[model samples]
Target: MNDFGSLLSQPVAQLGASIFTLGHVLAVTLIGLALVIAIPVMAMRRAARAQAQIAEEAASRARLAEERMAEIMRAQAEMQGRIGTIAEVFGSRQAELTKALSERLDGMTSRLGHSITEQTKSTHENLAKLQERLAVIDTAQNNIQSLAGQVVQLQHILSNKQTRGAFGQSRMEAIVADGLPHGAYEFQATLSNGNRPDCLVRMPNGAPDLVIDAKFPLESFNAIRAAAEEGGPEAQKIAAQAFRRDIEVHIKAIADKYLITGETQETAFMFVPSESIFAEIHENFEALVQRAHRARIVIVSPSLLMLSIQVIQAVLKDARMREQAHLIQGEVSRLMEDVGRLDERVRKLQGHFLQANRDIDLILTSSEKVTRRGAKIEALELGEPAPTAPESRATATDTAAHGRLRLHVVEDGE
Candidate 1:
């Protein structure tokens, strides 16, 4: 230990006396080489690590991209399936809408055709009715023209006194014939006093027959009217006086001739064929009318005389009904007795029908029992208990009867 310490302190090595060995030199050289190699190796190793890291990162990114692509492909498949379903739905809907539209259009077209046909028919019917109405109106117009010509001819006939009297008599006869039955009235029949009346209505109940005279004082009334229209009071007054005198004389003549106490009615009718003349006499010569009434003469227009004839007919009808009252009552009583006999016979027949129905019910019950016994016997021969027989059905009957006779048939089933 002393020697080693003296050698390190000897400074064999004082300044310029430093000692060098092979081992020391080699040691220093190895150290330097080691430093140089280690530095480069370390740097290469760092670069390799960095490159490995980059490669790892790239691999991760590729995996993520593949995953995203798989996801996108799956989504595309799903979207395609959804789109196909939507298209199918839309197609079916479109077809349905088209068919519905077509059907609706057809129905509307049919309806339009029917409406047009009906409208055309209605229009034709209306046209036909209008034509018929026009024809009717034309016929009415022709009738009016014919009536005017007849009125002119009537005026010519009425210009003569004899023709006017005949016209009045004809009018009165027509009225009497239209209103009364045959033989109830007589035309131009001479009375016991030798006065021939225009018409005589025979009253019932032994009453005197009514007399109707046709002659009237129309000439004097026509003169008065003409004079008045000529515009002079004196002419009108003179004409009116003459008309009064003529009517009074005619009334007296009719009363004397026609009024037979036992043969004619108490009051006699003076028939005036013209209602206009009747109205004029009443309006302008009321005093003459009163005088005629006092003389048992009733002045009548055609319409008034027709009404009187109708009254006479009604009276005759009432008298005939009165005369037949007892016969009608006897017929009614006989009819009632016959109805009573029919009712008694109907009741007796109904009783017979009830007894027959009861007897039929008994016979049907006996037949059903017999059929059941036969079924039992058949089962006994077969050596087995009889199966239950089917239930009997209700009977049906059709019957027709008149008075005491009847026809009927009954049917039954199981």
Candidate 2:
């Protein structure tokens, strides 16, 4: 501190005489004071201006922010109004959509219900038809079973010779009865030679009766079939020979018994009821058929016998028509005579009618003349002047002439 004061004392002593005048001292003090005051005032003014500028910027920002806030509020209010309107519209549209969907659903449900009902009814009808068809199939199955049993019975009947002969006889008789009229054929009729044939068909025109024999030799044919099936040529040949012999003998018996000279036909029928046996005979035994033909014994199947019966029926019908021809002609002649008598009666009636017509015409003329005279009498009025002598005479003469005309008409009518 002493060193610092000494340093200052030295400077003060050195300039004390020149530098320490009262005016210099006063000026230095005043300059120091002015610098101190001016620095603070300038700093205060700059701070105030900076604060005012900051306040202005803050006020401007606040105003801008308030405007932006007001705009935001208006936008929000407008958006809310638009949103409310959109909400109302959406609510109405949603209600309409719901109502439309309900209507569509109701309609769809009703249609679906009707369709289901119809489908159910159709399915039921189809089921009923299927049931009816199944019932028909069941009935057919039952019929087929019955037919199978009948076939077995037929096989049993065909096994025995006597039964087989009766079957053939029955079949032949059935064909005859179905084709020919009653009394045209007789079963088991005894011929003049004391031989009873199986059937006797009365031929037309007083011709001899046709004979049909029904017995067939089936045993030998069965044996031939069995031997053939057994696979031995020699056995089949033997069986075939036996069959041919049996057939020949049967044909000879039928020819001898049925072919009567004056009573029966020259050719006799040998009825074979089974078409298969007949076919087998014709196909495999041609010689036997030829032999039977030579013996005047025509071997006929059931179909051929039926055809023969039909021919005989035609012949009988023709003969009956021929027999009744004279009677028919007589009836026709009597009818024509009756028609001629009726024609003569009609001509007489027509003459009577013409006379009546002429009488009616005369009566009509008389009535017309009377009507004209009445009209003339009526025309002579009481108020007018009476007729003179000449007119009166003329009227009297006209009346007399009408009276004569009426008399002539009456006479003609009578």
Candidate 3:
């Protein structure tokens, strides 16, 4: 602090000097002028430096802006490329989806069309079958109606005793004719006891004939049925008793007329034409059945009579077959002998064929030897000069005969 004060006092003391030289004044003025000029020059230089710094800064800012713009433009270009790629991918996917949708639609259409066609065909076939079945049902309905009418007519015919008996006789005759051969059965045949039966079946092997009586007592049975339907219990009882008596009388009459010891079967069949009447007798008239059975009389319906005829026919057929069995056996024996002779001839023929095969094998061996000799002669003629010898000059036929002789000699050696 004292040194700074002394320096300021020196400048003040110099200024306060009384004696003033011209050189001192001139030096002071020059120094003041130099300071003034130097001050202005420094200020100008500083201003110029400031202006240059501002210009460099402005240039740097301009370059940075340009680089930022370039970067932005590059980014924009990359974005555009990515956007293009995305658009292309979207377009390709759309095309694939469209193609897949189209193929699916086509497949679905084909399947639906096929399914509809098959369903239509099946429906048509079902309709056709239904129509055929309806036609058949209609025909069956018509047949049933006709059968009902026939049953009504049959009932009317059987209502009368005479017609019912005639029906039974006719049915018995028809069955007899159908089941028995032409000469085997006789209708209304006369027996030795001066009694005429409805039908008689002759037996084979001198066996007794079978009598089938067609007359059946249906009057009392009809009365019983009518009384029961009328709700008259007493009348039903009386009619049932009369029916029993009528059945017994008819059974006894058949036994007396048909049961001949030397002529007819021990048991005779009494034919009941109506199936209902036959069922009634068996169901309600057990005592009568037992009595008839005791008398050696077999009661039969139309169906049973037919079955009995068939049985008789079968018996006759069996008897005839028994009579012919010996002839069949003799013929079969002769056929067997012929077969044995044929087998022996076949064996002889097979042996002859085997001998022929052996002979053919020997002929083949001889032919092979002849072929080999010819081949040797051919090779000698091709590769060597011919010898001037008589054997070599021999005719072709002589050479062939000589080869044959050599083949025969070879076979003899073997």
Candidate 4:
């Protein structure tokens, strides 16, 4: 049991001890609890003051951000307005340039078409006029060719040599007929002297007269034209030369026939129609001309023949003057013969007048005797006077004596 009681007191002791310890422990614990609570209140008050400063700074930053966003929106609106104004101005300028180009192109096309139409019309008019002129030129050319052919035919007929010589002779005769009387010319005359010549000129006095002949040579003169006809063969050429020699023989024959002696012994003539032919004969055959002249043959051209005819006319005129002088001489001889016959008759008349005077004296003597006888007888017979016998007889005797003529010398008139 003690043990039990000790245990209980001990327990009390232990409990008291425990209670005191507990009280001590409780006081210490309370003091530690007050220190913990006061430290928590001081730390909590410092944390609330820091939280108030952080909230005021956050509100100031939000106000600054809102002002910056408003500035950006205003800038975007100004840029959009400028872009719309530039687009409207560019559209108006493009429409004006396109309308000006279209008007200029239309006007140029109409001008080009008008110029081409006018040029085509002018070219057609020029072509029609040229064709008309060509037709007129062709007609004129054909007429000219026909005229040329007719002229050539006329020239061929005129060149025949024999016909040409006859033409010249006829022309010469026609000209000479105008200047003189027809009786003065003798064409193809035959003279009284038994010579035939081309012409025989008569002088005033009746006598044999001058002679003239026409000489015409053909072949020698024809040879001068050999170039006109080509003599093809040698034999033909030789025959032409022989023909020339025959012409020379005919010239010599004409010279012999015309030249002969006449009353005056004058030269004879040979007449050639051309002067050019005369010149050719003289130049080529000088010896033949000299021989002919010595034979009293005179070669004469047309000009020289005319001069010779004038000289013959002058000689005929002088012959007529001499014939008039001979007639006057015969009349003077007859007048001298009549004067010789008148002188012989005057001497015979003087002898007859003397014989008549003697007869009258004898008659008077017989009458005286008769008176004596009568007186003797009258003694026987008475005598008386007769009255009428004495007065009447005296008147008759005076009238007979007055009728007689007297002459001394005969003058030219008697």
Number of the top-ranking candidate, with TM-score as the measure = 2
Any idea what lDDT model 2 has?
A: 0.70
10 residues in a row with least lDDT, candidate 1: 391-400
The digit string of per-residue lDDT tens for model 2 on 251-367 reads 988888879898888999998877788899899999999999899999898767766876776677566655445445554565555456555555655555565567557656755
Question: Over the stretch 117-186, how does candidate 1's per-residue lDDT look in tens digits?
Answer: 6555655655565565456555555644544454454344334344333346677776676567677888
Which runs of model 1 end up more than 4 angstroms from their true locations? 1-167, 322-326, 340-414
Comparison by TM-score, 3 against 4, better one: 3
Pitting candidate 2 against candidate 3, the one with the higher lDDT is: 2
Ranking by lDDT: 2, 3, 1, 4
Candidate 2, residue 352: Cα displacement in angstroms equals: 3.6
Better of 1 and 4 by lDDT: 1
- Tell me each candidate's TM-score: 0.42, 0.45, 0.41, 0.33
Cα TM-score of candidate 3: 0.41
lDDT of 4 by residue, 189-281 (tens): 665455566665654556656666664554445555452265655745564455446545655675556555563235766666776767866
Q: In candidate 3, list every pair of residues with a backbone clash.
A: none
lDDT of 3 at 292: 84
When summed lDDT is taken over every stretch of 10 residues in candidate 4, the lowest stretch is 404-413
Which of candidates 2 and 4 reaches a greater TM-score? 2
